[model samples]
Target: IPDDLLEAARIDGASEFRIFGSIVLPALKPIIVTLAVFTLLGTWNDFMWPLIVLTDKDLYTLPVALAALSREHVQDDELMMAGSVVTIVPVLLVFLSLQRYYLQGLLAGSVKG
Candidate 1:
């Protein structure tokens, strides 16, 4: 929505919450989708924090478990590659699925004020 339209709505007595819900939220869809994708990718690929926090074997996340597996299977190149693939696939899928929104966000962020 244009600034003029928003101003008109405000002049016509629309509340801030109503304007936000009806206009701002729709305008923010692309950036919101982009952020969600980035957040999912970040969480899915996180390793160091999970490793440091979760001490129990049963509580380990995928990356931590994969790191442990790599350590245990040092001699097995194939197993290590499989672990890497497992770690990468979800991030790849998310990036592919939301590439357009991600690129849009990147471009939007790159513009100088």
Candidate 2:
């Protein structure tokens, strides 16, 4: 919807932000919340990619931090366990908040008349 609308707007000579404001974003709100939750969980639990990309402590994503903690501090380390908990909390929060729409979208996509 957004891309098609943007294409139509471009042909009509609408400015970039104007196209987005008028045609793209309004049509996106229905699915935006669900996509945002998925994005949050995916980024929060991302491990090796972040481990490979993030070298600095301040930039450490929770999954990579948890992996590093478990390896150096022992598998049973309290800090590692805490890191695991921290890594999962966002997923739980996002899932709890968005599960209704997620399930709704899933059902809608999977069902046919």
Candidate 3:
């Protein structure tokens, strides 16, 4: 993201598109990854909005469906635990898969590049 680098690219006859693709996007990688992780976590755990917007039972998200399940099976601890596991597993897997990139993004602005 140095102005000098962009100037050099322009002086070297690189098109604006090429400079952006090669320089701007690479510089934005950490921020983009961090944002994606945060977005995924937010949407994955979101409950109230989906509950209000999605009226159909079949269109329910995991958290809303799980809430409905809990309402129906209040006395069923084992089933509730299983449902919780099912709901959490995919989120866990996604975080694990992107953990390194996510952490890098979080730390990107912490130290001077």
* Number of the predicted model whose lDDT against the real structure is largest: 3
| Residues 1-113, model 1: lDDT tens digits | 56776787799899999989876776677878878887987888788998998889998878889889878888999988888898889788877887776555444422232
Over 1-113, each residue of candidate 3 has an lDDT whose tens digit, in order, gives: 66777888899999999988977776678778678878988998899999999989999998999999999999999999998999889988887887777565454433244
Task: Please write out the lDDT profile of model 2 over residues 1-113, one tens digit for every residue.
Answer: 53554676899999999977866565555488767876876776777887888779788877777766677777576777677777778688867876676555444322222
RMSD of 1: 4.8
TM-score of each: 0.65, 0.54, 0.69
List ranges where model 3 is wrong by over 4 Å.
4-13, 103-113
What 10-residue stretch in candidate 2 is worst by lDDT? 104-113
Q: Residue 72 of model 3: what lDDT?
A: 95
Error of 2 at 6 (Å): 23
Task: Order candidates by TM-score, high to low.
Answer: 3, 1, 2
- Candidate 2 segments exceeding 4 Å error: 1-32, 102-113
